[model samples]
Every structure is written in structure tokens, then in C-alpha cells.
Target: MIRDDHQAGPTLTSPRSNGARISLAHGGGGQLTDELIGGLVLPRLGNGLLNELLDSAVLPLDAQHRLALTIDAYVVTPWRFAGGDIGRLAVSGTVNDLSVAGAKPLGLALSMILAEGLPQRDLDVVLASVAQASSEAGVPVVTGDTKVVGHGQADGIYLITAGVGVVPTDRRLHPDSIKAGDALIINGPIGEHGLTVMLAREMPEIDSVLRSDVAPLNHLINRVMTRHGGGVHFMRDATRSGLAGLAADLAKQSGRHITLDEAVIPVRPEARHAADMLGLDPLEVANEGKVVIVADRNQADQIVATMREHELGKQACVIGWVGDDGDGICELNTLIGGRRIIQKPYGEQLPRIC
Candidate 1:
């Protein structure tokens, strides 16, 4: 467990451009990833809107509306996993990013990088999955590009998807709106996506029932926003670095302490077992279909109840709460009645899982 005094800071000690090269950990979406972005990427490219660092960039549109845009790349090694494929992952990931920003998705743009000698059948399957996921989310793929590279130059396939949505000027969700006593909730069980993919890739012989929880969350999020927009303060999808990453980030961004109750955090039995066997912390594992929400404390129960009505959020429950202002520390109340600080993982635990 990371100690509270273990402050997060720039991990790179050398000059920005001197003898530095990118590594897989830089894309792991953890502290090192943050350092890379904050230390290098932001300094060169950040603007007012980009500096906000929200999952989606909220841009001015007309007087009554704004635009939300997000893009993500899918490089899951197998490109296909239990319950979802790369195409589904690409579309769902993009759509969820928009939804957490309180936007209604308008359309998507997809680009594919294909390796030469890749089977045409595999491409067909991926495209079909993309179409089905798009239809399910009620979002259309408006435009796209495709390119082919030498057999060894690329993975079997790589998918990049960008999504655009419209948000009412008043509905922007941000950490600035969160306050002490706000309730933190999650939509369903965690760690399924990462665990499922890992098992499928590394331990396929194991007879496990784990499945990736990769699905578009626009409808479920829209439902909550429609009924409890006023109570909702902030929302984020727990993706690359999982729930712990998001919580740690929330504490830092909100400048408030956060407390999560371990007993109530939903982790399925199979996922927990797999995590233990693999020496992994479920809290730090990736999740594709989970969103951590901060809402008014008084309406936490109501929001959970509302979430339960949706298929995607049937296991929704309160997992934590925002505490008084502090140095942005997050603590977990363990199942054994112990308390420990929660910090973002320094690097990737499971790579190529998303």
C-alpha cells in the first residue's frame, strides 16, 4: 500500500527532450502517464480547454450548447476477448467518454490500421462488431479511414475511434462542482474487463467465466442525468488505470480527501479469485463498463436506486465519499477494518488489456 506521504510528482528527472524515449508504461494511464502528459505533452500543446483535463474536451458551440469530443485507440493483443472484441471496445470506449462528460453522442469517426497478411475474415468480424455496437448505442459512424502496413510492421489490427457529442451549456460535469460530503458511487462490479482479457490471453486453459464488461454507457448515464442532473457533480469512466486511479485523481483534482469502503465495492467472486491468483489488486485493474460518480450525498441512495433499474448498472452502489478539504489524499477502509492510502499505480499492471 502506498503511504499518504508518498506525494505524486514528476518522475522524470532529466531534460524534457534529452535522451528520452517512450515506453509502454507511458501509455498505462497511471502516475508516469500523468507525468508524461503534464511534463511534456501539456507544456507544448495545452490550451485553456485542454488544460481542464476532462475525459472529453468541452468546446463552445452555440449559445445554448457545447460540443464534447474524445478519442481513444484499441490495441488489445488478441483484438477479440470474451464478451467483446476490439471493434466493440473501440466504439464503447469512445461513447462512454462522452457520456461521462454529460453529453449525448452525435456520431463517431473510426480509423483502422491493418497489417498485411491479416485474414479478411477477421476484418469482417471486427467491422460487424463495430456496426452492432454503433447501432446499440444509437450512434452512427460518419467517416473513417483505413491503412495497411507490412505484416510485421503492425499488430493484426489497431482501431482508433473519435466521438463527438452535444452537451447543454449548463450540463458540463467537472471536479470543481464536487464538494465535501458528496457520495461516490460505481455502476457495477469492477476488474472484469482487465481480468477477462488477461485470462483469455495468458491463461486460456483455465476454465473461468470472466467476461469483459465492455459496453456503451450513454443510455444509462443519460437516464441518470435526465433525472438527477442537479445532484450529479462529477463522473468518469474507470478505464486504463481502473477505479483506484480515478479516485486518486479525484482527490488530487478536488483537493479533498476521499474514503472508499472496501466491503461495498462490488467485485465478482471469479474476478476476485483471478486477481488473487495473478497477484493483482482489483482496485487498480482496468474496467471498460464502469463509471465512478460523485453526487450530492442526500441523493446517493436515490441515484443508486435509479442505476439499479438499468441493465448495465444493476449492481450500482455507494463505494466512497468526498471528505473535507486536504492535500488530496485517498484512503481505503479495508474489509479487515484497516485503513490505507490509495495512490495511482506508477505504471502498467496489465498491458494490452484494453
Candidate 2:
């Protein structure tokens, strides 16, 4: 545990950088990954409208205000991981992406790629899982396409999904508004999805049943938008590129810095132990069901309580706060009282773990 700085709020001590790189760890959905996206990728292609990091982008209309859109692909190895399958993953990934953008998912456009010799029953199982996940996620599969390849041409299966949602005029979200001194919150434990899939792929000898965190976070989004004034500054699913990569993106867009207390950062003991054995930092691991939010401290308590009201946020915490570091840097104030720059992840640590 880190010494409490809940009072002084640790000062930002990280060096600032603009370069960002993609790494295997970037795919883990932890802190390193967040930095990569936050620092590098988003600055080049996105604007304020694209920065909210919500499940889907919410557009305020002078008159038109009914549709939201997002597209995503899943090429996760071991198509069938502990918690979900490719089909379900494809659907939920798209749905959550749209959801985080401040949209309520309504329909999906799906596509699948398969290899020869793959069992039809396995495909059936995956499709069934997709249907079930869509139901649970409150979205529908409205259309799709499929393709097949020879035995060596494909890696079992790949899937892509496009989703559309409706945005209410009342809900307004933007990432640029993510000001200094804002509170940073996580909806649940981090790294579970990435680690679970890794456990299945690399260490099946370990008896623990790890599951993917591939569920839609729309309902949770609904609860938040309905309860709060939708004063949310930013929102993002901890996906390809972990929390670090995502935070880096936040820092870049808002033109400020973020200081996270290592102790307050939440990670399950099981995940921590597994990551230790694998020489992985839970911060850079991937997660599907989790989200990172930057909002006002006054609203942090209410947001956390609303999150806990849902099944996903029982471990929700105000892990850190946005600060006036002013150079787009993110720092981790160690439990031992040291501070370090959160560099972009380098090589692949857990490839295909997503």
C-alpha cells in the first residue's frame, strides 16, 4: 500500500514527452498502454469531438440527435478464452466502445473470418455466446458477413463489429474539458481480462479459472448519465493499450498531467499474484469491462456510488487526480515514496492477450 497523499495530493514529478509507441504491453489494457494512446496515437488523428473516450461519441444536435457510431475488431488468440469467445468479444467490444462515447447501443453490424478445419460446433458455440452477450448487453445483431480461408491462411477466427447508438441531448461529454485537479476513477479492478486470457494461453497448468472482462458497459453508462448532470470530462474502456496508455492520451488531449498514487490504484490480489509470476505489471495489462473516468472531485463520490450500484464498480476508487504538470506527462507516485515517468510501453509483453 502507498502512503496516503489524499491530502497534499502528490505533486506531478514526471518528465514530459510527445513520442508514443505501441507495444505488447500496450495491448494489456493497463497504465502503460493508456500512455501510449494518450500520448501518441490520439493527438495525430482526433479532435475534441473524438476525445471524450466514451463508449461511443455523443453528438449534441441543434435538431438531429438520435444516432451514435463505433467500429472495432477482435483477433484475440485462443478465440475461446476463460470469460468469453470471439463472437461475444466482437459484439461487446463494439457496444462498449459506443457506450463509452456516451451512446446507448442499439444495433451492430458484424463480420467473421474463419480458417479451414475449424470445428463447426466451435463456431456454433461462439455464435451462441455472441447472441447471449448481445442480449445481456442490450444490443442486437442486425447484419453481418463471413469469410473462410484455407488451413494455414487464417488463425482460427477473427471478428469485426460496427455499432450504433442513440445519444440524448441532455448528455454532454468532452475530453478537452478534463481539467487539472479533476478526479480519476476506475469502474472496477484492472487487468483481469488480459491476465485471464493469458492464463488460459500460456499457463493452463495453473488451475485458476480466469475469465475475460468482455461485457458491455452501456447500462452503467446510462446510470451515470441519468444520475449525474453528464459533467463527465472523459471516459474510456481499458482496452487495447492499458490504463497507462489511455491516461497518456488524456494528458495529451487536455494539455495537462496526471499523478496517480500507486497504492490507491486498484488491482485484485489474484491478478497481482499472477502478474508477478509472469513478470507483468498489472497497470499495462488489458481489460474489457473496466473504464477510466476524469471528473470533478465533488462528483467523484456520487459517481463511485453509482458505479458500485452496478455489478462492475464494487472496487471503484478515486485512484488519482488531474494536475498542473502542464506538459502531457503521467507519473506514478510509488508506494515507497518514489516517483517515475510512465514511458510508453516498448515491446510485446503479452501479444494477442487481447
Candidate 3:
């Protein structure tokens, strides 16, 4: 649906929009494209850096320091769903990457690939949601581009966001810092975000109420960083591939095998119910606003406490520890006293997940 002004993404696809479905005109730089950007994109995402609208952004760089940058592309199916939509998911995904790396998010550059026959109103709604997410994250949409493809040349729409952030002072967080005794801490419940989309789209027959944990973790990260910056060995958000991949990466790269407690790992009741019905491994699903943190054993409790203070981290727990297995794999200690090897998922269980 089209509107004189841009509305949020979820609002765009509702029956009330003045325009139905999108068209090539929305991507053209003329009036329709102008409406798409001005009416929708700008209002939600515009800020000091973005409003400049120059070919490039000029900024002063700090001396003797490196910057952290991350880019994420959102192609989640059914763009709008329970909890969060693609627009907000894209923003949060990019920002969370920076946050887990001990960085303060600075700005985002958005690119939209529009399929022909898509509605102008739909573009407006999507852009507006992107804008709102960036605004909430305190990041500006500094620059962007739009391209239209042939009908069926693309899925409904695709969004790409590149983000930059500043790392903390005197922080040496890296996989190398993880020691054999460091505790593995998760910053929230395991499977909400992954199951939310799966159930929303009726994928894989997982049928309980669930939603994606798409949110900004900057504040939670900051709180934990404040108390344990030096003690933090590493941080990573579990996304398209969840904890197993993250755990395995830390295991191989840091030369520390990871051990996780099955019973202690947090999972929501809805997700648990759904997982039982579908015979799915929740660890294989995606999460937009969660992190796997490595902290010194002495500081693990403190880190968990700091995280729980933030709403995003209410279920934070130390579910594992660094161990000495040479295989560099993430091993789970099941509730039934059995051990299983956790590896990166072989293929896409759910595609189009940001």
C-alpha cells in the first residue's frame, strides 16, 4: 500500500495502505522514488550524519587505533512477523555485531534491491522501519542506493546494511585471551528468535508461539563491558548459525575446547514445546539479539549479573567452560549424562533469515 507519507514496515503491508503492491516506478529516481525515500526512508532513519547526503562522509579518525566494522544483509522470508520485522532486524543485526565486538555503533549505510512490480507503498513502509531501527540504535543512515530488477528477478526485496563502530579504550578482547578455565556465558535464552520466524511462516511444523529476539544489545554489552572489559576474552552474537558455530569457532581459533551443560542452557517454554513437536535442534536456528561471551572464571558471575540488569539479558547464564580437548569442537553434556558433538549446521534449515 502507498501513502502520502512513509509508515513503518509492519504498517505498510496492512490492508489500509493507499497503494497495493510495489512497482518499478518506486525505484526510479523521479517522483515515485522520491516519495519512497522522502515519505518513508528519511523520517525513520535520518540523523545528523545521514541528513548530509554527500557522496562520502567526512569524519575525524582517532590516532593509533583501529576501528571495527560489520555488514549484514536481511533476506528473511515473510518480512513482517511476530516480535520484529526485517527492517528492525537488519538494523539490530548490524549493531549487535559491533556491540559484541566491544564497539560503539556509529552509522549505517543501507542499500535496497527492489523487485519490479513491488509497490511504492511497500518500499516506503520498509524504509520507514529501517529508519526507525537506526534512529533507536543511535546510528544514522549516512548514505544508500536503490536498484530495481526484472519481475521475479529477485525475492520481494533485499536490504543490505554496513555499519561502523568504535571499540573501547584499552580493551584487548580477542579469542586468544580465552583461557582453558574461562567460563562461557550466554546473554539470553537460546531459541526464541529462531523459532519465532519458523513458526510464523509455518516452517518445519514447529507450532508453538515464538518470536525472534531482534533487538539492540549495545546497552547490555556496554554494561557488561564496563564491569569486565579486561576480563572479557571474546564476544559474538549467534545469528543465522547459532551457538554451536560460535562455540566451535572459539574452540578452534582460540585453541580451547568448549563444554556446555545441557540442563543449564536456557530455552523458552514456547520454543521448547515447538522443538519437541518438530524434532528440530533450536541451536541451529538464528538469533538477532544474543551473544556468546567468554569471561574469566572469577568474573563470570559478575558478568551474568550485569547482563541480567538489562531486559535483553534476563536469562544470561554460564552454560559452559573452556576445556582442553584438542579436537576444537563444542561438546554438549546432555541432561541424561550423554555427550554429543556440536558442529556448524551443514545446510540452511531456514533460508532468508537475516
Q: TM-scores for all candidates?
A: 0.96, 0.84, 0.79
The lDDT ranking, best first, is 1, 2, 3
The residue pairs found clashing in candidate 1 are none
Clashes of each: 0, 37, 12
Q: Which regions in candidate 1 have their CA more than 4 angstroms from the true location? A: 1-11
Query: TM-score: which candidate is best?
Result: 1
lDDT of each: 0.91, 0.75, 0.73
**C-alpha lDDT of candidate 2 relative to the true structure:** 0.75
If both were scored by TM-score, which would come out higher, candidate 2 or candidate 3? 2
Model 2 weakest lDDT span, ten residues long: 1-10
Model 2 alpha-carbon drift over 4 Å, by segment: 1-66
Q: After superposition, how far is residue 14 of candidate 1 from its true place, in Å?
A: 3.4
- Give the C-alpha lDDT of model 1: 0.91
Residue 252, candidate 1: C-alpha displacement in angstroms:
0.4
Runs with alpha carbons beyond 4 Å of true place in candidate 3: 1-61, 203-208
